[model samples]
Target: MRITKVKYKDALIQALLFIYLIFTVYPVFLMVITALKTNAEIIKHPLSMPIKLNFSGFIKIFTTQNFALYFRNSFFVTVLSILITVFVSILLSYALARYKMKYVNPLSIYFLAGMMIPIRLGVLYINELLNTLNLIDSLIGLILVYTAMTIPFSMFIFMGFIKMVPVELDESAYIDGCSERKILFRIIAPLIKPAVATVTIYNFVPIWNDVYFPLIFIHSPEKKTLLLAVTIFFGQFQTDWSLVFSALTVATIPVLTIYLVGSKYFIRGLTSGALKG
Candidate 1:
C-alpha cells in the first residue's frame, strides 16, 4: 500500500510538470501559428490553426527592416557583456574567497546592492553620464551598461562556488613558493567552472531580450538591438500581426538555442558546485 501511494505521488508530480510544460509552450505555439497565418485569419480565430502557410511576413521583415543591424548589435553587446562579467566576477570572487580583508563582507554587499535596484531607476543620471561621454546610440554604451548591470549576480554565483574551495590548497601552493597572484591564476581558479557557466547563462538571456533600455537609450537607426528591431513590424495605422509574430520568432530562436546548449553545462556546474558536500 505504501509503495502504491509513492507511485501515485510520483505520477501526480509528473502530471503537474507536464501541465506546466504545456502552459509554458502554449504561447510559443500560438506565436508560431499566428506567424504562419494571414492577419485576417488571425483576427477571425486567434487560437485556431493557420489556414495557409504565410511567407510574406518573413520576406517583408528581412527585406524592409534593419534586422541585420539589430542582430549585430545584440550579438556584439551580449558577447562583450559575457567577457566583462566573467572576468570581473571571477577576479572579485577569488579575492573575497581567499583574502583576509577588513569589510570584505560589507564590500560584497555593496557590489550586490546593484542587483536589488533597477538601473532604469537611475535613467536620469545614466542619461547624463551617457550624454557627457557621448555614448548615445552606440553599441559600446549598451555593452557597458549590460556588463555593469550583470556583474552583481555573476559575482554572487562565483562567490558561492569560491567559498566551497578549501583554503588548504591555496596555503599549500604558497608554501611551494607560489606568489599570491600565481596561486590565484593557477591553483584555485579552475574548480568554479560550473558556477561560471551558471552565471553566464543567467546573465546572457536577459541582456539579449532587453528592449526598454535599447528603445530609450538608442535613437540611431543603425544601433537597434534585436528586441527593438521587432518594433518595426508594428505600425501606427496598421499592425501586421503575422509579421510581428514572425519577427518575434526570428528574434527568439537564437536566445533559445543558446539556452538549450548552455543549460546542460549550467545545471551540471550548479549541482557539482553546491551538492559536493
Candidate 2:
C-alpha cells in the first residue's frame, strides 16, 4: 500500500510537471513551426505540421539585412562587457570580503544603489556624456553602458560568494609569503569560481537581450546589434510574421547556447554549494 501510494503521487507530480513544461515551451515551438512553414500553410493549418520546409524567410533576412553586422556587434559588446564585469567584480569583491576597512560596507552599499537604479532613468545624462566623448551610437558606447549597468549586481553576488569561502585559505596563502594578488588569483578566486559562473549567466543573457540601450546608443547601420536586427526584419517585410519568426528563432540561438553552457555553474552558485567541504 505504501509503495502504491508513492507511485501514484509521483505519477501525479510528473503529469503536472509535463503540463507546465508544455505550457511554457509550446509558444516557441509554435513559432519555430511557423518559421519553418509557408504563410499559406500557417494560415490554413495553424498548428499542423509543415507540408514542406521553407528557408526563404531566413535567407531573405540575411541577404537583405545587416544581420551579420548586428550579430558581430552584439557578440563583441557582450563578450567585452562580461570580461570587464567579471574582472572588476571578482577583485573588488575579494577586497571587501578579505580586508576589513572603515568604508567597505558603505562602498558596497553604493554599488547596491547603482544596482537598484534603472540605467534608462539616466538616459539623458548618459547620452550627453557619451556625446562629449564622441562615443554616441558606437559599440564602445554600448559596452560602457552595459558594464556600468551590470557591475553592482555582479559585485553583490561575488561579495556573498567570497564571504562563503573560508578566510583560512587567504591566511594560509599569506603565511606562505604569497602577495595579495597571488592570494586573490591562486587561492581565493579558484575557491569562489562557481559564483562567477552564476553572475555571468544572469548578466550575459540580459545584456544580449537588451533593446533599450542598443536602440538609444547604437544608431549607425554598421554598428546595429542583434536585437536591432530583429527590428529590421519587422520593417522590410512590412511586418511579415513568417520572417519575423525566423529572425527571432535564429537570434535566440546564442543566448540559449550560453545558458545551456553556464546553467550548471549558475545552479551551483545560486545554491552556494561550491563553498561546502
Candidate 3:
C-alpha cells in the first residue's frame, strides 16, 4: 500500500511538471512561429503555423535596421561587465570569507546592502558623476554601471562558495610558501567553479536584457544595446507584427544560446552554493 501511494505521488508530480513545462515553452514556440509568418498571414492565421518560412524580416533587421550594431554593442557591454564584476567580486568575497577582522562582518553587510538598494534610486547621482567624468553616452559608462550593479549579487554568491571551502587548504598552501594572491587564485579559485558559473549566469541575463539603464545613459544610435534596439524597432514598426516578432526572436537567440550552453554549470553552481552557504 505504501509503495502504491509513493508511485501515485510521483506520477502526480510528473504530470504537474509536464503541464508547467508546456505553459513555459508555449510562448517561445508562438514567437518563433509568428516570426516565420508574413504580416498578412499573421493577421489571417494568428494561431496557425506559417505556410512557408520567411527570412525577409530577419534580413531586414540585420541589413536595413542595423541590429548587427546593437548586437555588437550589447556583446561588448555584457562581456566586459561580467569580467570586471567577477574579478572584483571574487577578490572581495575571498577576503570576507578567509580573513578574521573586526570589521569584516560589517564590510560584508555593506556589500550585501547594495543588493537591497535599487540601482534606479542612485541614477541621478550616478549620472551626475558620469557627467563630471565625461562618460555620458559612452560604452564605458554602460559597462561601469552594469559592473557596479552586478558586483554585489556576484559577491554574495562568491562569499557563499568561499565559506564552504575548507580553511585547512589555505593554511596548507601558506605553509608551502604560497603567497595570499597565490592562495586565492591558484588554491581557492579552482574549488569555486560552481559559484563562478552561478554568478556568471545570474548576471548575464539581466545585463543582456536591460533596457532601462541603456535608455537613460545612452543616446547615441550606434551605442544602443539589443533590448534598446528592439524597443526602438517596435516603436518604428508598430503595425508590422511579423517584423516585430522577427526582431524579438533575433534578440532572444544569443541569450538562449548562452543559457543553454551554461545551464549545467548554472544549476550546479546555484545548488552547491546554496547548500554550502
Query: Of the candidates shown, which would achieve the greatest TM-score relative to the real structure?
Result: 3
Comparing 1 and 2 on TM-score, the stronger one: 2
Put down candidate 1 lDDT per residue, 4-121, tens digits, no spaces: 9999999999999999999999999998898899989989999999877988777877888767777888889999989898998889888887778997988888987886788888
Off by over 4 Å in 2: 1-6, 266-277
C-alpha positional error of residue 170 in candidate 3 after TM-score superposition, expressed in Å: 2.1
- Cα lDDT computed for each candidate against the true fold: 0.82, 0.83, 0.89
Compared with the true structure, model 3 gives a TM-score of 0.90
Cα lDDT tens digits for candidate 3, 151-189: 888888889889999999999989999999999999889
Q: lDDT by residue for model 2 over 58-168, one digit each (tens)?
A: 887788866777888889999999899999989888888877899898988787788657889999999999999999989988898999888887887889888988888
TM-score of 1: 0.85
Best first by TM-score, ranked: 3, 2, 1
For every model in order, what is the number of clashing pairs?
0, 0, 0
Query: What TM-score goes with each of the models?
Result: 0.85, 0.89, 0.90
Query: lDDT ranking from best to worst?
Result: 3, 2, 1
